[model samples]
Target: MRFVPLVLAALLLIAGQTAAARPPSAVFLNVVAHQDDDLLFLTPDLSQTLKASVTVYVTSGEGSHPESMTPEDYAEMRQAGERNAYATMAGVANRWDRVALRTGTGTTAELATLRARPSVKLVFLRLHDWSDLHGLWNGEVASGGTVLPTGSPARVEDTYTRDKLTKTLTWLMDHFRPTVIRTQNPAPLSGFYAPDPDNPDHTAVARFTNLAAESYEGKAQVRNYRGYDDAQLPTGLDPALRAERTKAFRAYADVDTNVATLFDDTASYLGWRQTMLNRWPSGVSWTDGADEAYAVLGDEVKRWRRNVFGEWGKPVGLGGSGFAPAVTVARQADGRLRLFSLNRNTFDVVTAVQDRFGDYSGWTSLGNPNGPGGDQTGLPAAGTDAQGRLWFFVRNGGGGVSARQQNADGTFGDWQDMHGWGVQDGLSVVSAGGRLQVFATQCSARLYVTATCSIARLVQGESGFEWDTSVVPGAAATAPTAVAGTDGKAHVYFRATGTAAVLMAVDGVVTDLGNPGGPGEVAATATGEVYARNAAHGISARGASGWRAVGGHTEASPAVVGRGVVSIGVDGRLTQLVH
Candidate 1:
């Protein structure tokens, strides 16, 4: 099939061209461990794909029991359910054209394309549910092999190791050349608990998928969806979305007898259908000083300096490259600005210091806390506490927060792990009342599904930091952005679950700040002004009078510097809204 034409057409159509109209060329590659996993966890995102899409099932999904049927029959039944579900999602007839393709790793996998919608394809690796893939990943079993389903067109005689599985997935990605890839969360805080709590096939498949994504040559955007762990979070889906997902899942549940009863258990099934969370949500990094604001524009750092007349000057690039858009800036007591950004290639936290002359030094790398090979760190959050000391905090590889403070003599101290686990990224740090208050969202540790998350606060104490966690009265959809108010209290802002309404919490009181309908990090300024992206992708700010339009489009969250609001425009340039 000619995919280049399709991609070109999609690009043109997305660019609002009126020329030759064609199907979208964008391809989505969704890698899941089980047949129903995609239907349960990846939808409305999976259903929203406009063009060609492919789903790779890494396992046969034949749990410990075959349900009075042979393992092959059970696996085939699951595959058939998936076909029907995909047909339902595509609004087509439940018919497929099945074939066998030999991969570069010498493995023959079954590929099925919807007869009515050829752009939708499915690849079944036919590996056993938990024992083959999960066991191999855990080193409990060294050599595992695939099993051909009952009506499969292929005969798989090859054995698979962890490395071999990763390579095979990479080969598939190379073949499909997807523009976007979706997979399960590799580092889930909780494990699967249905048949066995220790069976983590979803995690294993995600790990392999990430490895494949890293090795793939294409520039595909990768998004990791929370699997079973999403159950513990709030139900963020609207009723219409829940119904749509239920309809698609019901199509699959109708074919598989094992989970067909889930429909009768409305509460349990609704828990899975109502929530679909992304593991690494994008965060906007911004900071400001007395007369200057700094933010990441494109892959470089940019600064907007205030003139003598209090007019903001044009943004100037600081000449650093390969940096992620997320950045944090801390103003020193001596009137210098310190900028921190993640190196896109190495995932290392790099920083540049501004001198009195307003020029920035070259970015110096602060080695990843997880050591040289770890790529699990999130963007760094920087703040200046009492005594003119700079502190940097980042979500570590082990799902906890780690901190490093600047020494008095201009050097940095060793990283100290704060050991706060089950936390999402988008950390907010501010110095309030002569102490540092680090705010983060702490996920629930419940084994079952629930809508529970707390705003975790780490406050500086005389003998180190003390934890004071409070449950968010309302459901929070995104990570919280906090600012120290003039009253010396921390004000937190977050997008509410289900409604997408921006909400604020102060002194344990939660208030609705109106729904902007866009999802991202909410920006709270020190002067009690709140900013969020509206449905049209324009920045909206709330002040003493009410919410007002800021009149600029930004892909990243808005930030405040001095009295001006700054946002990275869609064109990767700085747009400031002066108050």
Candidate 2:
């Protein structure tokens, strides 16, 4: 998998610029409960959020075993590796922060930060880490590996006390104010709905996370982004079969539906082979991410490479990361809620509420909506309007940007052409009042992340074909973005000759925010204060307090939800601002 250095560098340069442009909308407090959770569960999202802020709340290491490493040692190494990795990708390691909280496995941890920024802190409550090697099942058919259930989440034996668990989690909720929280399920064959009470650590994580969300009283969104209860270990699939699943798996490991960033986000993501999660046998440690130790080299009898990498990876039956293929949760200022993701092109909204999610195993047809076979490429931004109306906007290849509104009743509105005459490669939509605000970027040919969302729009003639307008100070002409701010104003920001151009409707009169950077993005928080991310920095401006973060790395537009708070999931992490 030798790639051209130049191409990768070029892509990075472009991607870097893009990151400074679009930036994500959601302010995520990664409710991760296990090790390598982001990779195995939300690879697609982690792929894109690499540029944003993500705080991992880990209970245990690879396997909740003292043999793996001491709690103190494990915490240091894990945090160090994580920080180094994040800095390598985001390029703004200094802006990030990390802190460890004290508590039992049953409790949660809360740290400090503003409404915006990666305000998440890790709570290494001394909970049992579910061993990829040991669980409900015993080793060898004769080993006594059976599914067990223990009642009460606080009863994880001598682990964290119930009181300790509650306090930790309470502190976490009160401090971060996370709207979207994620965790694992009780069992493998089951999902969030299933109940696996035996493992106190597993059960505690779920119970504790739920408790936090509940404490917020639906004021935040919650979802189990992981739960591959099955066996994360490789099936030792006779070589040939293993390769097949890996490719399909990579397709998903590539993109983030929410962030719209790159796929295969990890530095080693590209060269990843058959890193098997579980090895039916133990003999291996997934703690150090040691691929060689747990790998199979065709066994001489069968020369096949199953890239089984459990160490520092996900667990058995799970994505070797204790994560999911694709799970989208929509949270907002009001509270926590579930989000529906239409499997790629299948507009059919695959409702995998429990065990049925993505289970093509017993599955039939999903009636993909982006046309029969479906366009796995991408879908337009799906947002709800004031009237409780569900909206669907697509950057139809030839049909320009088409939009359709779906009501809670499952019905749809007429598909209208918002970007008339010409077509765009990207589509973003936000509702302000009764009107729908959409933003798009027209690619010269195909689409790329560099398709700036922050760029200001200088509408070409009438067809809307050319996007030669930008907000970047001194940057030449570039395409601009079309977005509806929270204050009921529409804005378009872009880059020009490295500079930036901001065009927005201020009381019917278009006003410029300022010159922060190029092909950048702008999001309004509470009172219509706009925050833009461009170049390798960010800019914020409101009433009197002008724009700041002059240095930002944005690749997606801001998704502002709360009154004074705005969340921005970038590169591969979640960062935000609270005024």
Candidate 3:
């Protein structure tokens, strides 16, 4: 008890102070439900943490792979592996140490319960193993875990409790007192925790994180990072190992999964490369889920994955298939978030209930019996309009030829073939200065933000869809970003090409805000006072003057908040861009 008083208080002070530091801003405590889980959902985040040298705490690696070993032997080997893994991840053991401690349960468990405890300065957290079983990832049936029933997707131990984990976690926090903490979001988990069965560990982690950070209130930020999706890993024992290393990076990096551009590097370049090869001894596994994985991802994207491997023996493939259904995610004029979707043959609004009741579809959409891209136009970018009619920028995907439709009324529109313009992101459909403003990317990879009255073209057969274009002349945009500004102007930025892979921003005035280029899209910001994303840096705005790199770095598309915007970067760290 006396130790608690002294140690806990010290932990809190250190955690708080560490958060306010210059760059390498915050410290982190990772409470992954399983070993490989963090690798899947939290990879980039880890990269960012490592870059900042933030301390990490890991748990659960014993029970998983152990299904293959006796409890005693398995625990010993797994603990050794865990130690090796963390040591490799943090880059040093003098600054990092592995301790056998039970996490969620809080109460001291036997040595077997201890998983990962790093001794980096200014950090404290329980790295207790839920079961080393955390190494095995599952959830997606098509990805193959549906049948392999021996690992973590099958967590069967309750040796711990919320109360137990809380006491210990709180003690760590009181000790570390991190002003900004991280955990997985447990609320409305789509694949599992459906309608609240509540056996999952996320809820526990979130609840605990909430409680632990409560005393700090507005004084702190308890960010919820997405845990891994073992459901998506390629089926391979070595992939399992490699996956852990990836997770370590992403969790530290903090970027969204769908959009992050993975710059491939030799496995050896990462610390885990040599160690994983030495320890796990790759190229061996009981099951082969690669084909099934290829089947799920389809061919084109699989080709992208294949391109990365080159001719590396038997190539892994997710097969060639289009993509899953496109769901509309945008706020409606009626003050509710709606998801309009059509898959298979069903068509309807996706269930938009949010944390209000039970047995609810987190987001269910009925497919359009009329086919996905009905008529000449199919799916549209979900954007809200002036009158609040949600705009759907439908694309045929054959090329830039797409149409616009309104979800409130099933009635659709004709298609507009902007053949050369490959639509980037649906930035905005603002009716600021008379006509509707449309901004997107060109097939040539330049920025294009138009003040067009194209809504009528999609609805009618008229030829004139007022499209005004502004290109950065010769700027070859690797990843383009555009957003509307409160100053009555639209701004566009893109990752530059060739020698200066820098990101550049240009104000799509009826003119120019001048032009400036930088190092990474991770450094650019949207053009004005209204900010949409909290973690985006690759997209920034130059005032009537010049450069202010938005936040640290983010991958999610930027969206303007009412006044201030949450900017997320490739690094996944976020800052508010307050006008």
Give the Cα lDDT of each candidate: 0.72, 0.34, 0.32
lDDT score of residue 34 within candidate 1: 90
Clash number for every model? 2, 120, 104
Model 3 off-target regions past 4 Å?
Answer: 1-25, 50-59, 66-68, 93-106, 109-159, 185-218, 227-429, 432-482, 485-579
Per-residue lDDT for 1-579 in model 2, tens only? 111111111111011010122324443455555544444443333333432334544354434323544444443334333333333334333223322233322222322221223432233333435632132122212111111111111112233444444444655554444434555432222111213412334434554554444444223334443233212211212133234333434332332121113234322232122122110111101111111111111010001111434112221221111121122222222322223233321333332111324111221222333456433212334555555555555544343455555545444555554443233323444455455455444332111111122222322233422333332222212323444555565544433322344445433344655554423334444345555543333434444655555333333344343333222232223233433
lDDT top scorer: 1
Best by TM-score: 1
Better of 1 and 3 by lDDT: 1
**What's the distance in Å from true for residue 73, model 3?**
3.7
TM-score, predicted candidate 2 vs. hidden true structure: 0.33
What TM-score does prediction 3 earn?
0.39
Point out the worst 10-residue segment of candidate 3 by lDDT. Answer: 277-286
Q: Any idea how many clashes model 2 has?
A: 120
lDDT of 3 by residue, 405-448 (tens): 45565434443354424332222233333334444433322111
